[model samples]
Target: MGTAQAAQAAQTTQTAQTAQAAQTTQSAQAPQTANAADPGMEQAPIAYVGGMPPVMDHMIYSHALLDEFEARADGHGGQFRYDGQAWFGTDYDKLWLKSEGTVGTDGRFGDGDHEALYDHAISRYFDVQSGVRVDLDNGPTRAWGAVGVEGLALYFFQLEATTYFSDRGAAARLQGSYDLLLTNRLILQPQVEMNVYSTNDRARGNGRGLSDIDTGLRLRYEWHRKIAPYLGVTYTSSFDQAASMARTRGRQVHALTVTAGLRLWF
Candidate 1:
């Protein structure tokens, strides 16, 4: 009777152990089953849909630069000069307005060049510009159709070359400048400009072929990125018949001047 009782007790213990093992396995599988059946438990899909951010590449912008506004002393007298430009548009296309000129102590203004141009980007660092240029001052006003290319050259030199045509004659101009940093806020700049003509305009003191050249070196201290004060020396001269015309009018063919100016941009 004792042996039968012990065997029945062992069988009961075995049945309980089997039932607990089954319960544990079912508990482990319950979560997986729920995840498969419940739609909220699924991971969200990655896809490009209607809700996305906009790009700024097509946005418009504008800028203006007053490169030089200076007073010059050439021993004989004092003169005032100005060079500036403004542009409005997007990254690829723009409208450019440029003006530069000189005013003499004798209250005479000359060499005034103003332009309204359409600029198109053709390469990474260059632009092609086409438009009208008006020569206005104390002399006879002349109008011309102008085309030009301007950009950074090799070694980061700023350069511009433009040609003009009108009923009076054909003309071309080349301008270049370079900046050498002396310090974080100090710089030295060298600039040059040359003009040529196909016909003479005696009334305007212009001659055929190579007409005039202007070159200068300036040292500036930048109080701010948008403004600077500079001091420089400039040499301006006429060549060939232009020199003769200048001499005939009792004007110096060549003059060296000291300049003090401000450079501004925004």
Candidate 2:
């Protein structure tokens, strides 16, 4: 009876040990099961250690345009005319050069206007410019201090308004243009310019008050974005005292001319 009781006690102890071992195994596997069900809890967040990349605003650039390089034929004779501009700088600031003039059939140049300006962007579509203007041609030469505003107006009209101060007198100019696209590669443009002066300058053929106005309509075909050929008609007229002065000199008060030209840009 005593041996039988001892054997039963040993078996009871073995059963208790097996149960403890099974409990320990379940505790170890519980955490691994939870991690497998929710893997995101074990992941580390990403960090940005490197700096940002560069931007293009700091770079410099340049552009040139020959807006008008045309030959004009009037009733009296034929003449050549040119207007061009170039600029160098960043997007916000630039140095600009502009020139325009007419060459007579006799090979004499007249009415040459040249300007060098500093331009600053004042708005998304506008700029404020201050500069010097020099009239250099076969006749008398004049210099002026110039200030102007140039921009795209309502509905994308290009506009410029400038005032000039000089020893001879004060002068003002207004210029505007609009492009009407007729097709993907064809465009029609209308342009106008007016000049006004405060004093008479017989040497330069300018008179007090409203001096002159020039208007043109042109049709251009763009074979490439940088090159276009155009045909146009231009009307120029003297006004107020300018007309009287021109008539006294036996010059025509007005002229209507046909033109052929090329427009180029780079």
Q: What is candidate 2's lDDT per residue for 196-220, written digit by digit as tens?
A: 9999998778989889998999999
Looking at model 2, report the run of 10 residues with the lowest lDDT sum: 45-54
How does each model score on lDDT?
A: 0.94, 0.93
What tens digits encode model 1's per-residue C-alpha lDDT throughout 159-265? 99999999987999999999999998899999999999999999889999999999999999998999999999999999999999999999889999999999999
**Alpha-carbon deviation at 115 in model 2, angstroms:** 0.3
